[model samples]
Target: MKMNICMVGALLLLGVAASGCANNRDLIAKSVIPARNDVFTEGGNGAQAGRAVVDFTLLVKSNLYYLMGTYGKHTAPPYRAHLNIDGQTTILEADPILEDNNSVGLKAPESGTGWKYQFSKRLTLAPGKHRLSIALPIDDVIVEREIEIRPGINTVAVTPVYKRKMLRPYKGENFSAGVKTVEIAVN
Candidate 1:
């Protein structure tokens, strides 16, 4: 009789514990983009810019890290990557790309578009990996996906784009639209 009572108590406690885990995934209150968070799609939540930027921002709860993306013509004279990590801002330029920081990326890496480049930056995360957030202050464009980190070694990519000037005479007069693709993933 006593054994039966104890077994029932254990099962009850197990049920509650399982439910707690499910709730945690929903804790991130917000994400980087206003639309659904899908990196594989174009013009969804995040927008990849050219040398001419349409800036944006993103917001999150706590703990978790987020990434932004950019791509463009790499072999040209104007290429820049500007990032803001927790308020501390850093800008990467091409002169340093070849001089000190081996920060190398393929020029126009994407197929068909000889003007898209992709790259990332990883962040050192804290314990209790909270909600993931990536802000795009450039035109309110945020690029990120959901993730759960255990403790150490957490990373994110911050991609800002610089584009060659649109020499096309009709660019300003008409609607000019182009797509530059960059990707972020983990094992």
Candidate 2:
């Protein structure tokens, strides 16, 4: 009799755990549902009509750099990013211009002496709360945050920074550590 009772108890616990997992899965699915309407419109056409304008910029170092002869000619790999806002995903590619340490305002030794790629987008969105996500698949960098878009023009800047341990006296400009922190600023 005791053996049968223990088996029943274990079965009951397993059923409850399974049901809890199902509930969590349902919640996750609901949260990721795509937006019903296309919210991100390019350019500033609707800004005066009450839509908010957002100028977004993303800057990151190229994954690989080559030294040509002794001049150290740097080349930028084709960098692409996936940006998701309000459950809608958009793909963005870096601009043709490749900036160096001089234009980026970073010291050579500290900045890794690499070419930087930049991506910019001007978007018009409804003024309200938004969920923003950025993923750089090649660089293995992902950032997600909640942003409030107010009326008029807004500037959003996203840039990758060296890991804490990789900076300063320890060792600066080390790409081996990869990008651990991405700084986001909205103005």
Candidate 3:
């Protein structure tokens, strides 16, 4: 009777709600390298008491569109880094790491030689909680995270969110991108 119809309708509504939640599960589409358990392997020894040092490793994936045209593509792009501690924000300078033999992107290695490139910076921070934000313009994404510093050398590796589409057509410019929480660990 009427009770049976009401129960069926309620179950249908619940099913729809669960499917919507599934779509929102993946906020940022990217694979984390080194994994979470292995991030502390490269941080070296811990820092001294009352003082914490942070080492940053920037990883930028090569854009595949560069191979389509004859124009030279730049592998290193300038990035803006902001570190906020105790309500104070500090802007850090970014420098590019030169690859071996001046190689650009990841390609076939010549004989036994290999090359890699990235930007790195070290910051001395007081023992406590701090927030770090990195703005990467290549894909118009900003990564933000909160980290705890406790008498040790902390290493953070940053990279853009992975996307399946390699090439995106140029569109009209009046738009804003979404913000997602990027995980950064303090070793």
Candidate 4:
């Protein structure tokens, strides 16, 4: 009789444990359903869905000697940068130019000025490759590149630096003819 009672008790305990697991499974499913609703869609069709973000920074290079010899001071003129994402163009106005007066960091050369500006935007891109075009209207320069945006954070750096060779004097003049060039870097 004791053995039969123990078997009945074990079966009851097993039934309780199985029911608990079923409740836990339902709880897990309920928790995930709301999170799945927050997914971002890149296109109208239900093709691509996920969260995508992009961080972009702009760095402008300046030569201290060139500025001192030519203009006697470092200056950064305001310019606008435009980004084309998936055939959509967005304009980003340049912040007021700032000259770095502090000591140079180890990564930078000591003789030059690093005029920097930055902007960021979160993108809802499809889960595949896309075309991105960056345009600096001040210099009339545009760079077209393809990038694959995954379901996480992506970083990009756009460096616009004037080439020293482009500033040569024209027709034996002491001052150089006004010329500007942009160098782009992507990361």
TM-score of every model versus the real structure: 0.27, 0.64, 0.45, 0.49
By lDDT, the best candidate is 2
What lDDT score is found at residue 147 in candidate 2? 90
Cα lDDT tens digits for candidate 1, 35-81: 32221221122222311111222111111112253323333334334
Please state the error at residue 27 of candidate 2 in Å.
Answer: 16
Worst 10 residues of 3 by lDDT: 171-180
Candidate 4 least-lDDT 10 residues: 170-179
Ranking by TM-score: 2, 4, 3, 1
Per-residue lDDT for 91-136 in model 2, tens only? 6676534334544434333344445567888888898999887766
List per-prediction Cα lDDT, in the order shown: 0.32, 0.65, 0.44, 0.48
Q: Which ten residues in a row have the lowest lDDT in candidate 1?
A: 57-66
TM-score of 3: 0.45
Q: Candidate 3, residues 1-187: lDDT per residue as tens digits?
A: 8999999999999999877544422321221111223122222345656667778765443321222433223345433444433334444444433233335332222111122235566666666765555554334454556777667666766643343222332321111121222345556
Model 2 accuracy (lDDT, Cα): 0.65
> By summed lDDT, which 10 consecutive residues of candidate 2 come out lowest?
69-78
Best by TM-score: 2
**Which regions of candidate 2 fall more than 4 Å away from where they truly are?**
1-37, 65-77, 96-112, 164-169, 173-177
Candidate 4: residue pairs that collide: none
